[model samples]
Target: MFFFGTFRHSLDDKSRCTLPNCFRDDLGKVVYATKGLDNCLNIYPEETFKVLCEKNAKLNELDSAQRRYQRMFFQTSFKYEVDKSGRITLSKNHLQIAGINKDIVIVGNNDHIEIWDKDIFEKIDALQNEEFESNAQLIAQTYKE
Candidate 1:
C-alpha cells in the first residue's frame, strides 16, 4: 500500500518505538529495516522488501559502486517483528548511524517508512524546502508526458 504522512514518536527506555496505527495495520507482524539515505532508517513490508531484494540482485555485480551498495545494504539490514503493543526495537547500530535519540519523526515515504531524529529531520526538511521549487521543476522535467 502507498504510504503518506508525518508522525512524531519516541523510543522507550528499551529502545522500542511504536509505529503509527495506520502503518501497523498495513504492515504485518514482521518487517525489514535498514539504514536509508539522509541518515534515516527505512522499514519495508514483506512484499516491498522482496521487490527491493530482487532489484538489488539484478544490479551489475561487476560494478564497484553497485557491489559496495549491495554489501552495505545487506550488512545493515535486519528483520524485526512488531510486538503485540505495535512496537519494534531499534538496534543500537542503526540508532547511532541515524543519530537518533529518544525523540523521532516517522515519515510515510510512498512504499516504505522512514525513521529520523526529530531535530535532524526538521533541519533537513527546512533545507530541502528552500530549494523545493527548483527541485520540483527539475523533477517535473523528467516526466516524459
Candidate 2:
C-alpha cells in the first residue's frame, strides 16, 4: 500500500496515540513497529512486514554485517494491534528509543509509516527539503523507468 500525508498527534498520558483514520483503515487490526533508520519509528502492515521479513531472510547469515543488522532489527521490533478506540500504545522502551515524548509527527513513506518526535522531524524535514530536488534528480538518474 502506498501511504501519503503528514499528520500531527499527541501521545496521551497512557502512551496511546490515535492512528490516522486513513492509516487505520488500511492497516486493519495488526501492525508492526520497529526502530527506523533515522531515529524514528517505522510502522508496517502485517503483510508488508511479512514481505520485509522474507526479503531479510534471504540475506547471508554468515556475513557479519548482515548478522549485526538482523540482531538490531529483530530485537527492537514489536507487534501491536490497533485498539477499539483506534489507538496504539507504544512501549516505554520504544518511545525512549525514538526520543518521543508528547508531540509527534506521523509521515507516510510510500509503503510504510514513520513516527517522529516533532522537533526532531522538523529539523530532518528541513534538511530533506533543502536537498529534495537534487536527490530527486539523482534518484531519477540512478533508476530510469
Candidate 3:
C-alpha cells in the first residue's frame, strides 16, 4: 500500500479541512485520525487503523511509565470516515493539540498520511535534518555493506 498526495488547505472554524481527493480515492471509504508525534495528526485507512490498534493494544501494559506513553497516543486516536465532498471534521481538541487552527498540510507517509501545521512542520523538519546529519554515520552503519 503506497500513499501519495499533498494537500494544503485551511481548517474551518468547525475544525474541518478539505482532504485531497487523490488521497481518498484509493484508501477505501472509511478513514481514521490519530495523534502523532511533534504535534501532527496521523491518518489511516480503516483496516490499517484497526491493525495498528490491535498491535498497540497487545503490548504489555505492566510498566506504568510506558502505559502513560501508550495512553497518550492511544487515547487521542479518533476514527473518521471521509465524506464525498472530500472533507473531514477534525475534532476541536485534536486541532488544538496539533496547533492547527488554520493552514495545514496533508502529506503522504507510505502506509499513512500526516496532517501538520505548516510552520510547525517546517520547524520539526529542520530539526530532524540536524539530528539526521549528526547520526548519518551511525545510520549508515546499520546498513549491510
Give the whole-model CA lDDT for all candidates, comma-separated: 0.93, 0.92, 0.82
- Pairs that collide in candidate 3 are none
Q: Where does model 1 exceed 4 Å of error?
A: none
Q: For residues 1-145, what per-residue lDDT tens digits would candidate 2 score against the true structure?
A: 7888999999999999788999888887999998998899999999999998888778788999998888778888999989999899999988998999899999999999999999999999999999999999999998996
- Structure candidate 2, residue pairs in collision: none
The whole-model C-alpha lDDT of candidate 3 against the native structure comes to 0.82
Across 1-145, the per-residue lDDT of candidate 1 in tens digits comes to 9888999999999999899999997888999998899999999998899999999888887999999999888899989999999999999988998999999999999999999999999999999999899999988989845
Model 2: worst 10 consecutive residues (lDDT sum): 52-61
Model 3 lDDT per residue over 59-129, tens place: 66898876777787688888777777878898887888888868898888889999999889888878988
Error of 2 at 111 (Å): 0.9
Ranking by TM-score: 2, 1, 3
Model 1 lDDT-worst window of ten: 136-145
